[model samples]
Target: MGESVAWVAVDWGTSNVRAWGVSADGGIVASARSEAGMARLTPEAYPAALDLLLTDMAIPAGAPLEVLICGMAGARQGWREAPYLEVPAELGGLALSAVEPLGTRPGLSARIQPGVCHKGVGSEDVMRGEETQLLGLSRLLPGFSGLAVLPGTHCKWAELDGRRLTRFGSAMTGEVFEALAQHTVLRHSLAGDVVESEREAGFDDGVEAALARPERLLSSLFRVRTGALLSGKSPSWCRGFLSGLLIGTEIAGFRNWGGDEEVPLIGSTALCALYGRGLAAIGRKSRIVDATDCTLAGLRAARELL
Candidate 1:
């Protein structure tokens, strides 16, 4: 029954949970979302949170609904620990490693897919949600190879050889931006909303400054405040400048990892667009993949294997 419900897919992150009703043909029939993410819930609370999200769905009675999930829900502090599979792992193998959470509701089966762990690299890193998205990307571009950059709170740059993930590195760019804008002196420099053109210009300028002289990152950050005071730059410009500087520095480091090729950027549309700009600044190209589509495809891919 291609038109009937086949299963459910959930991307449960730290701040939000989004679910999709997938049909037998892999198309999404319905969807739901909630703010009860892993960061704010205890293990005991996971079931209720999920129940609240699924209560209004149109799944048929007595149907065997398989709920496949990815992201922080599999973390040690999340719903249940889905131990990470080490790198050089095949993207399609995630389904075999899925772990079922205890205390799930009756008549509803759920499996949380494990994230990937990379050790012998730049940083001892772990990624839960992104691995699933990468799986989706693999399905989207069959036999694809190269780097996939997923930008967000903790940006990840993963190198893929075919469907196998070779190695990866992460950057705390987004988190750092939030910290600087809220806790540091830079907050004063980035105070208000900016026009679209001014934001883009400020962002581009920051990218150029960071790439041209990365060693002076700290000093350049301070210049945001100084520029605001002396040059009378608006807060929006300062904010855009700060964003570009952080993102550009991150890209400058990663662009040289492989070659200056078209990298696949996956994440939220806005964040991916931001990373795309930063990539272009480094003479690199990027293809944006909608984060939700990747997550859904990844979940469906895992479900099919099961």
Candidate 2:
């Protein structure tokens, strides 16, 4: 795609940075990525990171390029603090809440998109990259109303009513799985990466068990260890079972907390597939939306507001 770059969109997360060169109509014409995510950069070091991804674009001459970013780059500990937009907020105007950083490269205007916060809901919860993806769904399909799940290290379940993110919740499914599989007795039994027949069966079994008794999650967790020791379960099965148990428990908890409409899972393909499987296990349904598509649409949406 040798099209001239009219603007740039970026999703700057904790571990990496991605950029897309777009035409005036917001169609992505070029793309690149860098390892210099927020966790590796200080305020002054941000420009070089941007430089890594914004180079050699067919930028229009004598015109300043526009750059819109979302994700951890806006966190308090990120490149620059872009603050959080309090909940009950409409998704369309996220860019209005964004903040301009002081030291972008020459001929570039940059703003970091703000995250959303829910202070007085059931508990205090906040999100960064996930919000842009949510906004993208509304952009990709206007007047879209329903529940959406953005799954990752901390999976977010957000509610959309009348185009506003009315309320949402987060689940630490990935982190918990990491801890339980590496630090506990379960680690010894979850050392394999193969997902053959035994693994798939274990996964389904774990999901069913969680949905059947969401209340007994704690006790069910230990079953991995016992099954491995006495029942002669394979390490692959333990991995699948532990993964299913955590993801299934999360789905069950969400169902208990009013997750009734069709959920469009916004994230990577493989992760969303796993969530889709878990949902199908409990008689629920979901659709997958690639995170790249969401980020681009979201950044474009934010750019239009500017």
Highest-lDDT candidate: 1
Candidates in order have lDDT scores of: 0.85, 0.83
How much is the lDDT of residue 213 in candidate 2?
Answer: 90
Candidate 1, 153-228: lDDT as tens digits: 9999998876688888899999999999899988877777668887888898899998888878888998789879
Query: What root-mean-square deviation over C-alphas does model 1 reach?
Result: 2.0
Backbone clash count, each prediction separately: 0, 0
Best by TM-score: 1
Error of 2 at 195 (Å): 3.7
The RMSD of every model to the true structure, in order and in angstroms, is: 2.0, 2.1
Clashing pairs in 2: none
Q: Show where candidate 1 strays beyond 4 Å.
A: 1-3, 60-63
| Residue 134 in model 1: lDDT | 89
TM-score of 2: 0.93
Model 1 weakest 10-residue run by lDDT: 55-64
lDDT of 2 by residue, 228-300 (tens): 9899989888888888888899999988543556678887788788899998887778889877788787777
